[model samples]
Target: MAPEYALNGLFSVKSDVFSFGILVLEVISGLKSKGFYHPNHSQNLIGHAWKLWNEGRPLELIDICLASSCMLSEALRCIHVSLLCVQHHPEDRPNMASVVIMLGSEIALTHPKQPGFFTKMESHEAGNQSSSTNEMSITLLEPR
Candidate 1:
């Protein structure tokens, strides 16, 4: 689920883009975002992908099985496009038409900003505990 939808009960075209981005990441990595686990960090699949991307190791996110058959450049482009779709702000995300163009062409992609719900989980935290990160707090001001 997109962070805005999950937290604010808001939904939009960008929300579907976020979901698509996650699906792309999951497809490439052969891992589910909800239950993603990494021995070295508490990041879920999206965070882990972002970490690898920042470290110039995006290829490391690809599944080993596909590594043998997938075109490296295409995989990298997909990752780039997926990241763009999942930007933290809905305004920052491209529309579906742009996403299709990005996937089908060699156009240059912009660097992805921090993703929504980018919060890190505790290393000891279990997957069953709140699948989505809840970092934002709302304090409703009610005057009596």
Candidate 2:
């Protein structure tokens, strides 16, 4: 979920894009984005991916099941595209159209800026974590 939506109860197309980005990363890693915790780094999935990508070890983000069969280049591309979609500012993210083009071609991608919501588990709560998410989405109708 986008931080703005979580913090301010507002959502837009960019917010859905943010959710889509998380979904892509989850698909690649076979882990839920919201609940993933890295004990060593004290970071969630986005933070973990950002760290791995910056350290030149992005393949670590790929699921072990696909470790041998997945093409490194394709997996890296998906990571890159997903990162772009999760930039901290909605304006910094590519809309869905550019996302489609970026996914389809070998065009050089701009490096992603830091993603939002890099929350960490409290030191005492890191390992004893539960499988629940802090889900906070709401929908309502406004009278026109």
Considering every candidate listed, which one attains the maximal TM-score?
A: 2
How well does candidate 1 score on lDDT at residue 49? 91
Superposed by TM-score, candidate 2 places the C-alpha of residue 109 at a distance from the truth, in angstroms, of: 0.7
User: What's the true lDDT of residue 41 in model 2?
Assistant: 68
Per-candidate TM equals: 0.85, 0.86
With a 3 Å backbone cut-off (N, CA, C), the pairs that clash in candidate 1 are none
lDDT of 1 by residue, 1-144 (tens): 898899889997799999999999999998998877787778888899999999999999999998899999999999898888888889999999999999999988889998877667776674445466789999999999
RMSD to truth, every model: 9.2, 6.8
Stretches off by above 4 angstroms in model 1 are 126-144
- In Å, residue 140's CA in model 2 sits off its true spot by 30
Report the alpha-carbon TM-score of model 1 versus the true structure: 0.85
